[model samples]
Target chain A: MTSAPELVAIVPAGGAGTRLWPLSRRSRPKFLLDLLGTGRTLLQDTADRLAPLTGPDGLLVVTGTAHAAAVADQLPQLAGDGAANLLTEPSPRDSMAAIGLAAAVVEHRHGPTVVGSFAADHVVPEPGGFHDAVRTAVEAARAGYVTTIGIAATGPSTAFGYVRRGAPLEGVPGAYAVASFVEKPDEDTARGYLATGEYSWNAGMFVARTDVLLGHLTRHQPTLEAGLREIAAAWDTPAREEVLARVWPGLTKIAIDHAIAEPVAAEGGVAVVPGAFSWDDVGDWDALGGLLPADEAGAHTLAAATSAGDNGAARPTTAGPLLAIDSPDAVIASDGGAVAVLGLPGVVVVRTGDAVLVVHRDHAQRVKAVVDALAAGGRPDLL
Target chain B: MTSAPELVAIVPAGGAGTRLWPLSRRSRPKFLLDLLGTGRTLLQDTADRLAPLTGPDGLLVVTGTAHAAAVADQLPQLAGDGAANLLTEPSPRDSMAAIGLAAAVVEHRHGPTVVGSFAADHVVPEPGGFHDAVRTAVEAARAGYVTTIGIAATGPSTAFGYVRRGAPLEGVPGAYAVASFVEKPDEDTARGYLATGEYSWNAGMFVARTDVLLGHLTRHQPTLEAGLREIAAAWDTPAREEVLARVWPGLTKIAIDHAIAEPVAAEGGVAVVPGAFSWDDVGDWDALGGLLPADEAGAHTLAAATSAGDNGAARPTTAGPLLAIDSPDAVIASDGGAVAVLGLPGVVVVRTGDAVLVVHRDHAQRVKAVVDALAAGGRPDLL
Candidate 1:
């Protein structure tokens, strides 16, 4: 093996999966749920997918301090059977901070000829195809352009933002120049864009050389630029906490796409690799069925009663203590106690030891209301 | 006050409440659920409801051996704190055997003239109505006729059997001759019968001299007749188990309505007090809400969850440790480990330490299927 290209993997494992509730609690988020009961969690699966590409020592994960222990425990392949460079944030400041921090660490350690920012909570079924896209993007990143792995739009998914591809960049034949970044669009507009075949779901996976990413950030978001340099100077250096505390909260809470990637494209720089390896952010409850081997009629246990009426069985004559019963297309999770839903569709039920929650799944995007109410009521203990 | 009519309240606290599963188990049946948390179980509530009518010495309860302890625990008003004359069945025999045993004991101890049979699990909202009906039925029974309290039919309820009224019997003028008995009819036929205004719900509550009931049993169900006499011969006498074992299972599983009430009505001899009081067998989960305090949308709980829409101020939240968000018309009950029901309607979710059950209120009739499955799976340890 005569010197294969140096690979660096930046794993962003942060979001508190509130939409997947009950099972995905504040303490243990969705990446930890045994949705498939395959004895591996989502974050572990993501790490396994990237293991062959980066090898053990080259992978670094950035997460909040609250989840550091859990993230370390899940990624067992790390050096000394411990998490390799488990970067902990002082607080949740969103993806821009996480990616920038990861970039700084990778540049300092590996000289970042090519770095892959992979979401630890994503589900990529065809690992081979995902590897191919990562390989192609690595070639493009070597030519000094920031590359994002654009998932071929499967349907008009209004839940995710979209990226419109422009003409192919020079020297990278199959990759297209990024034209514009679209915020989550309405259903009809999403459908229209899907029909045109020039748009893809923003899978949040990005590839770039150290110089290209830092250059893009410096031009578009100077506030993040200063913070990234400060955090980088203190990397494995003392005063790390003091530096992070000064700059992390001061930066605007925005995704890297909005702050840096999209602006780089507008300034005629960013590129896209349209690949068909089947990817998902694993963002919500509805996304689980596609990622795992579900029972016929498509149901999985998130600690809820799963009755398959599609099997033509009479009233789901299954044997077991069913924690809760729900209508078709509903997601119910219980702690063997607090949350039980009956005749509900498109809803999520979550039960913690002290608090139980029931929310309409469609309105699941509004679950922050529950947290806000609890917090406003001076019950920080519940939050 | 003039001596109250001699009232003997023979409460039948038998039969497993399988329809209210998880919450209502073999160890803790529906009568034990603190549905209203009114400092009483259903058995306790039933006894309390009859407190004014039956003096301390007049209340007799009949339950199986397995549940005698539970029954005793619930009602403190019965003899020996409601345990005296608590006739436990030789085994898991049906209601007819339990009723016969009660009749034998009542006649042997309190004479044949005035005894009333009431079901242990029901919610009669108007105690005054129940009191009036009980008094009237007692007067009518003393006049040498069997008197069953009949609820005025509210609608065409296909769920319950109906009793047809005939001519008024002599001396008990408010009581009518029971012209006939009808099984649960088809919806259309039930509607036709209801329109005629000549039928009432056969609630299985009856007031009759013990001798009169025994006579009717002898004329109709001779197996019940033989069993009753054997039970009577061994009454308060020794060698209880030996005699009960020989006679109990031989008694048919026929209900009192089919064995005695129907036969007497066929002969145009029985009468019913036009009972203005309401009654429910409390037969299934759908029937439970009527007996409990329900909100405007008719939701109740051992534990329940309701939803708050975009305008959070519109939803009234729970007052305890549990939190419910944006759920409506669902019944949730928990001992404390957090039960949350999301978007659901007319359903029951119950959680106990060992088991959890979920079912639609309408399909609650099939909860016994789940129980049977649990039992058949050779987990009587759980059942």
Candidate 2:
């Protein structure tokens, strides 16, 4: 096994995650929430997963200015590294700028080391498979390809984009040259892609040498690249805030896929490393419900299993007891008080201190519309 | 339009209303709650409806000992009669004892006066129609018959029992002899009942001269009648508590319908006055939802309408603002913070400070099972 000591995991912790609203709010986003009832927040779990590969003090978290303090509080170990690993963006400028800035900063500090960007709100149940995929991707990255770990498409899921694998890499056994990156497909198309057995779900994870990622960005999104470089130059200095305030907002707002992966793949410079781990974005209550094991009543409670610590001791969150009667496949999440769901099959009930959200599983995606309505209704306090 | 000066209103306020769990509890039942978003509670509404017929001192409220204070607080005008009109039962001995004791007490206080017993938790929207029906019932009652107000059956609802009307009475113009009283029927039977215009919903509103109601009770339930008579003898005296404490528990636990109405109808001694007013028992959340007006989004907010006073001025309750997004036909009740329901049509969400209940409209009747489960689960605090 090759230990890539120079590799750093760059975690871009963003997204309002309105679909998980009342649980994932504006102030407490999904990344900061322990959604799985696994005692650790998604960000902490992401850090734990990458810890084996990156080693201690080798993880970088890029988050919004509003969430920087919360990110720091959830991850106290970053304090030992002078908290330099925690990067706070002045404001959201989309994925390209966020990841590019982190890449440029890592390159400046470590001199061309490999950096892997992972979302802080996803779940990978079996870290062994993830670590293996990351190792293969890192090797491909060292060989100069902007590599991504493609999650093995378990079903005909229309929620995620797909990456088509071309020919296998010559020296890298588990890595393959990427043919193309496709947008989220309809069910029929997703089924067709799954039938080919060569397409994998793009989980937005990218492993690449910092210079290579920045070079791809420079080639395609020059303005964003230049802005990220300027911010990186002042990142470790007293001029950090000043430079960020001047250049960050002007940076092009685009995802890393549009700016780098898709363009780089067109030039035959990207690779795909198949990941066999159980993975999910937990995009909505329905998705989250699928991840939780149901009790005897077939009700999924996002509390009981979540109250345990890493050592299996009780570490209860604010959620009270949940009672479900004759409600099969009900998903209940509460941080306020006891929730009782009766006779509603596949219903989703979420209770926070100030807000309560009730939705049916089929309508989980429409929760964003609720957040939008709240915004339009001038309830920013809720949003 | 002869005014029945000798008439008195006897309200028997009981029933835990378990189907409306988390809203109606053992201590605070449906009668005490402003369920319709009307400023007046069901009990208060009943009192208000009967006040014009029964003079200020003619309304007698019979309730369990636990709720006597709340009843007194809700209907303070009843205190003017030295609290003599408010009858507190030592414990629940079913509706028969509850109404029987009040009937005997009224007979004791005002000999042979007409007394109408109405449930404290029912709604009659058009009081003019109710007044006409009560007048007809009082005429039938003055003829020495046990008269009941049979609500005009709006639909083939299986939630309530049916009173089959026989031929019109000899002298009472709008009153007819009650052929029989049927139990809550199956859907097919209810549809058949609705087809026959002779059948009306038995709303359990009984009007009779106090002595006449007692005569029927004495013949049908002699022991219960004897116990209530014994209790009534000492009711307004110093020995009232002693007699109640000794005789209350020994009274037979039987509903007035089984003990009096059904048997009396079998003997051709019962009469029914067809009530044209809109009436509902508010038996479950679905029934309650029907009584509430929908907002612009087609969601029925039970709290918003309930907070207003009798004059239609906003008397806001403690409930925070409710937000419903795309959830048409949703009924939301909360005494807690804000409640948001999204994409769940015909859903019912109720929240109190200690508990939350989420159920579908079709499943609203099954809420009693939730309360039962809570009690079985040792969550009496929630019950």
Candidate 3:
């Protein structure tokens, strides 16, 4: 656990999560929400999972200015290390800048150490399997290979990208060279990938030496790297606000997958650590229903949205009462009021304080249409 | 129009409307609710329909003691005439006792006036045709026949009883001799009845000379008629409560159709006055949905339950807010909370203050199962 002297874990928290709208709002994003009805929010859960691997002062959280306070509020340990441990982007330039800023800042404060980027809103149910693969990924990262912990696929799910693994690295025992990173495939293509048994779900989890990441960024996204480096130079000082105000707005807006993982894997500089932990990005209500236990009616009910384990106070906003009859496989949620469902199997009901959403599980991905409709319908408060 | 010297209108208000549970409680029966989202409660609407025919002093409402205050509160014109106008039975003894008592009371007060008994919960839209039919029915009643207004059938509905006309009465124009009074028919039988062009929906709208109706009751249900006469004799006096308490529960519990109409029609003492008014019993959520206009999503949304037409102040109970998406033909009602439906066609959702129900339209009649389960499951408050 204490093998790497300067392996800092970085968390990139963002996204409006529009598909999970009415529950996931702009002011209260998904990362700060207990979507699974679990006692800990996704960010807090992410912090707990990495705390053992990163140690007390070795974890960093980079979020937008809007959610910075909430991110720190959920994970108070990030606050103890001062401004250096919690990086706030003035205006979101997407994942490339968010992660590069943290990597550059970590290198400035503690030299070019191996740093890992994990999303603040992913679900890794058990810590043991996650910890094991992360340890191997950290070893590969220390060995100067850009590494990622690829989740072992449970099905031919087309919602997430896939990573192909090749021959094992000479020095790193379990880490294999990542052959390529592919886009979200069609269902049949995903089936073919699964049949090959050489592909894992690309969970956007990347671990690499700070020097190696900065080196790849210099060769690929050079302008984005320079702006992040400028902000990192003044990050621990009073000049941080001034430099961030000047450089943050102009950083290249690209995901870490497109900027680093995909191209770096093609260049033989990336390694894949196969992770056997049960994982889900929780892309929609259908996915969320799959994660929850079914009740007597075979419907998944959302309990009071209280995070009991994270030392957070019980919120007044709750999932309220639900009476479901003959509605097998339906997901019913309410905001401090009673809801009833009958005969509508696989229906998704999301009743919040201001807006309510109802969609079939088969059309869960199309909830974005309702969000878009609300926006066009002069209901910005709902969005 | 006012040829008959004495024409009294009697309204029998009862029935918990178990199919519309939570909305129609023991305390707030279906007759007291403005279910169609219109400004008039069913009882108030019935009073208004009969008011023009009965005049100020000619209308009497026969309800149970439990609903006396609400009945008087809803129809203040009845309050103007004191306890005589608002007759409260000690207990429910079905339709025969309620109507027979009203008829007996009319004979005692007005000496065998033609009294018409109309149920408190049937919807007769456009009262022009209804008033015309009642006027003709009163004429037939004055001619010594136990006259009933038979509504023209809109479809082969199997929910209501049917009456077949034999031939036009020799004395009373537009009145026909009833050949038979049939119970609710099966779909094929109802379709056959509709094809005959002589069958009409038996809407429980009976108009008869109080003496003639009493005579029919004496022949068919003598004990019930004697008990009703005894109570009616003391109805306006201070001993009304005592007489009701003694005789009401002991009277035979039977529907008016079984007690007098069926047997009397078989004996050629009954006559049918054809009614062309649009009519509905609104027997269940599906029927109620048919009565309400569809919104953009083709769902019938229940509005605030305010009887604006009546002088009574609006009760706090309301159907609340609803956001429906892709839920065509859904019946969604709420008691002051937001409800949303998505992707379900013909679904019925009733969310009240204490309970909620969700059932598809095809299963509307089966809602009694949920009410039964709630009773069996120790949720009597919901029932």
Candidate 4:
């Protein structure tokens, strides 16, 4: 078999947010949590999946300073000399800054290689399909097209934005030109997109040569691109911290979707590689409950991390036994005590040391309102 | 106002069964708990409501050995010389033994005084109506009847047993001979009972002369009565522990309703004083949620006990904040963390030191299934 192309996987380890309150807090973001009750955390799982594609030294993680140490701890590959690739942002400047800085730094070290940006917190169950999608995207990247892996639409989900496919890329196999990028649509609009069979979910998995991404940024957002380049130049030098402090704070805070993806697609410079793989952002408790495995009783439990020395244990925040009764599809996690759910199907009960959250699956998104109430009620410590 | 007679309130501090698990454990029975957000525990509240009628040093308490210390701690009246009136059972022998033992002891100390057995765990928000019922019951008791306060049926609550009223008692006003005492009925039967105005809920508040209660016990359950009397004879003496060790375990584990109320009603020896006051057994979370006062948002929050030094606060078992959102009439409680309820109206989320319970009020009585599940799953410790 032929070897995979030279590509760096940039994982922006942020945004497991308020929608996953109590479990995913400001102190413990979603990427750092073992939300899937699997052997590894979301960040670790992302690293493991991308490791084969990027090779040992090609994986670079960019996370907030608050989560930097935790990222390093979870990823032993980042120990010693490998620590150089683990980038820590001084403060949050949105996704554009996080992904852009990592891309710029990779270019500074390895000169214009293919790098794909993947969120550290997203869930991609089977690595086989993901690897295939990434390889195709990387080939399109080598052909000088900014390629994004458009996840095959499982359903007309109104939660995610849709990317419409146009003509097949002339040079690259399994790659198509993007017609347009649309924001989250209403049910009717999303259903229409599905019927056309030309639409896929924009999962934000963009693969491109460092030069092409920076060149697009230069044309779209020149000032933001320059600051990222400055930060990357001094990233490995003794002036790293000082450069970040001065340049990072002033970087224009915008999502890469706004600064690059939408604009590049408009110019016919962006390509879509349809990813026929299960991918989820795990946006809210409802989405998360759907991702978790159900027991014989049909109860879905979010157990503790494998780091605790037990594969499927209690919550990482607290340790105890979990039990669900008459509560089918119950998403139960407790901070430090036993949890038992009863007589409620599709119940989501997450109890942390600081707070307990109870919501039904249908009302999962409404958990944001609860977090807002707590903040407005002057209990931000709970958030 | 006519002075309340020489009546002694025998508070049977027992029976908050598995339905109220976690909050009411074997070590901490329901009677010892402040299920209400009110500062005083059910036991303390029972004593407070009865103190005026019982007079100084006239109130007596009978509780299981495990909860004796907690009972004494909550009721300061049980301290010093008053400790004599606080009776402890070496082991639980059900309601009949508990009430009988207290009556025998009360008669031994105070010469067959009119004694009323009020459960420590029941809720009586208004003392006026409760006291009026007891006074009328006391008159019936003095006239040689085993009188139980019949609560005016608020609804067709199939959870409670019903007492059918007969002809009015000859000498006692507002008191009638019990036509029959029925067990918990089906919804159809309960509705039928409610249609007849003569039917009232059997609140289990039995008021009677100690001799009358003992006489019924002697006629029906002689062996159990004799054992209780023997235990009572040695109760306040040095041989108290020795006699309890011998007789307590052998006594019949039967409810007072079966031993006396049911049989005595057959012989026309049972009287029921109509008590038109709100009384709740606090049978399950549904009943509890109903008994608790609602806030402006219509959420009935069961806060920490007043003993916590904060009037309306978190769960008594925990120390933290509580928040309820779009979930109207949500009953949220936590053992030791802040609790938030979202979008589930009439939801009951109870997190305890050992386990968490989530159910809707519509399925509140079904919480017993959760407890049973825990027990079957080898988590009896949670129960």
C-alpha DockQ for predicted model 2:
0.69
Candidate 1 regions with alpha-carbon error over 4 angstroms: A1-5, A79-84, A238-254, A290-298, A302-383, B1-5, B79-82, B219-227, B296-298, B304-328, B354-359, B372-383
What are the lDDT figures for the candidates, one per model?
Answer: 0.69, 0.86, 0.82, 0.82
Model 4's C-alpha root-mean-square deviation from the true structure amounts to 3.6
Candidate 2 local lDDT, B81-149, one digit each (tens):
479789998888888898899888877766778998898999888899999999999999999889999
Per-residue alpha-carbon lDDT of candidate 3 for residues A236-320, written as tens digits (9 for 90 to 100): 8889888888888888899898999888888999999999899888888898889878988899987546222345522546333
Tell me the tens digit of each residue's lDDT in model 2 across A69-167.
Answer: 878877877766488889998888888888899889888776788999999999988899999999999999999999999998879988899999999
Question: lDDT per residue, candidate 1, B132-243, as tens digits?
Answer: 8888888878876778888887779887888888888777657888888899999899999888888988888888888888887887877777877777677566666778
Query: Candidate 2 local accuracy as lDDT?
Result: 0.86
Considering lDDT, where higher is better, how would the candidates rank from best to worst? 2, 4, 3, 1
Per-candidate total of colliding backbone pairs: 13, 3, 0, 3
Ranking by TM-score: 4, 2, 3, 1
Give the range of the ten consecutive residues with the poorest summed lDDT in model 2 chain A: A305-314
DockQ of each: 0.33, 0.69, 0.36, 0.70
Best candidate per lDDT, number? 2
The alpha-carbon lDDT assigned to residue A187 of candidate 2 equals 100
- Model 4 chain B is weakest, by summed lDDT over 10 consecutive residues, at B306-315
* Candidate 2 TM-score versus the reference: 0.93
